[model samples]
Target: MIELKREGDVFVLRMDAGENRFHPDFLAAANEALTEVERAEGPKALVTTGAGKFYSNGLDLEWLGAHQEEFVPYLESVNALYARFLELPAPTVAAVNGHAFAGGAMLALAQDFAVMRTDRGYFCLPEVDLGMSFTPGMSALIQGRLTAPVAHEAMLTGRRYAAEQAREAGIVQRTADEAGVLPAAVELAASLAGKDGGTVRAIRVGLYKHVIAALRGPALPE
Candidate 1:
């Protein structure tokens, strides 16, 4: 589900080719990889990308449907991961190599920067269409990272923004061809890796203080 590789000062965390849904095992693998990244020595940054088809489709609906009782615990774990990314000691970038929907989009937004594939793939929040809604923490994460108008359109309309549209809306910092996505992300991460880890972390924590708090706080009623 997750593959970790080091390219000089940057760590590339690749999601295996698939829907890359946020299943328990997926979360565990991602968390374990993140722990390794955090504990590694020397200057480092992270670039997260998907192998094919999807950066992530979102939460594992099939699993959740069969195991409804695990919903709250599952969300708790998801939120924890988001908070971790938001305040990771080093800079992080999301290489959106393919479709990023719902929780998948949230995961990308949790990063410090995003680079998406322009020729294909979408970035969308379809919770409304799925008869669901964002939790308080989720809302905070989106609102904190995006402009108010962009957040409103994305959350309320469930629009499927292609890479160009997403970049125009400031959801993504740059766009590239499929082959260019991960490389662009890695280059960006490598360039930013020179910043002091503690300073970067402190700046992120200060900038996203409210969102981190909401992510770590209790979820509102669903």
Candidate 2:
């Protein structure tokens, strides 16, 4: 479950305890929350975080394994969500309170800023290790967000980056102790909450045009 709460002008989205993997239900819930945020009035920004030991462990692989035929549609939905975040009309932040792996890491990347827990937790893209390749959209999203060398290392080596390492590599903008992650993210979002939504959306769309195009493009075959 994804819980949506309001704190001043910022909306905090708390992912459920456990791995917070992207099962279809979880995706639907998140999208619904996003919809509500988008529709609501007043100054607004968004901060996404998770409970327990994992910010998110990524895809629901077990479900995917049993429902092989759904792969294409599932990835399409995932790409749509990423694209949506890229074009969201307000500032966004990811408060990575715990481990963020695979698609979870990608989710964080989709945000405008990331604040991660420094005492522990890791951010990694394990696609190569898992014997999977990045989809074109995923590749574009990562490449667009990170510098050439950082993106290369992360995608090719499947490195697990600790908070400080991630900040140095520009993967995350800030690091905090576990308890401070969400607050830091919320603070960042709150600071940027009053920007004109139309202007923000337009600028983001123009800046990430190629990435959004790739994400909204056709999904690769399984």
Candidate 3:
């Protein structure tokens, strides 16, 4: 299950896998929590993390392999979440306290920034390896935020990377100690809280839109 809690100026969204790797009810709860976070007008920032050990181990291979019909709606649902992150007005940060796999990694990357635990886990995108492809929105996000070579590597390899490596690749801003990952993420978000919220949002929207303009094909930069 996922939980959303207000922490003064920020909100914490956590992923709890329990014993099941992929739980449909859990996913639905998480998505709903995200929506509520979006609607929380006064919260200055968002901190997304996971409980216990893993940030997320991507999809639950067993659950997914067993309940085939669930995949469609799940993927569709996550795509919608990706869109919400893209349009979110508040500054957001991911606290990758543990490993993030496939969709989990995508959710973390969708945040405006990230603080990751250097030794606890890693990041990977294995959708293609799992016989699926990342949504187009994910493609746009990677292309815009990550260097071509790095993005290409993740897409091609479907391998996980350590936090230090992710930081070097330009995905994570900093690597945190295991004990402080979420706290550090919240710290960064808090720093952004005092800025001109409207201005910050305008910049993100304008910047990504301009970036996609060229991605449409390629005209000379105006």
Candidate 4:
């Protein structure tokens, strides 16, 4: 289950389901929560985190296996979700409380900044190992967010980066103890909460136009 609550000037979106995979229902809940965040008035920012030992495990492969026919549309929705985050009016932060793999890593990449847990967890994109290739939008998001060398290394090697490693690679902006992840992320979000939402949106939309177009366009390359 996902929960959305306000903490001072920040909205915390907590993904509490085990593994927090992208099941259809999970996507629906996330979208609804983001809608509420978008509609809120005045100074605000957002922080996304997960419970237990997982930020998210990415797509629900078992669910996908049972619903193969829906693959295209499902991916389209996933792409749209990434686009939404890119265009979200408020500044956003990802509190990587634990492991973030594949799509989960992309979700964190969507944020303006990320704070990862220091002693545990990893940031990895293991699509190659899983014999899967990224959807077009996913590729765009990753490449857009990361430096050329880092993106190439991460996508090609499927390396598992610990918090400090990820920070050095520029995958996460900060690292904190497990217990401090959320607090640090919230503090970061709150610090940027006073920026005008519309201006933030405008700048992001303008700066990431190509990335947003790729995200909002086709999930797969034509």
Point to the candidate with the largest TM-score: 4
lDDT (Cα, tens digit) per residue for candidate 3, span 20-68: 2446676678668767866766647888888776887755667777877
CA shift at 30, candidate 1, in angstroms? 0.6
Model 4 accuracy (lDDT, Cα): 0.94
CA-lDDT, candidates in order: 0.92, 0.93, 0.74, 0.94
The segments of candidate 4 whose C-alpha lies over 4 angstroms from its true place after superposition are none
Q: Can you give the TM-score per candidate against the true fold? A: 0.98, 0.98, 0.83, 0.99
TM-score of 1: 0.98
Top-down lDDT ranking: 4, 2, 1, 3
**Candidate 4 C-alpha lDDT tens digits along 1-222:** 999999889999999999999999999999999999999999999999999999998898889999999988898888888899989999999999999999999999988999999999999999989999998789988999899999999999999999999999999999999899999999999999999998999998898888889888877788
For all candidates, the clash counts are 0, 0, 0, 0
lDDT pick, better of 1 and 3 = 1
Which pairs of residues collide in model 1?
A: none
Instruction: Report the C-alpha lDDT of model 2 over 58-157, residue by residue, as the tens digit.
Output: 8899989999999988988899999999888888999999999999999999999999999889999999999998778999999999999999999999
The candidate scoring highest on lDDT is 4
lDDT of 1 by residue, 22-113 (tens): 98999999999999988988899999998777999878999999999988888878988999998789999999999999999999999999
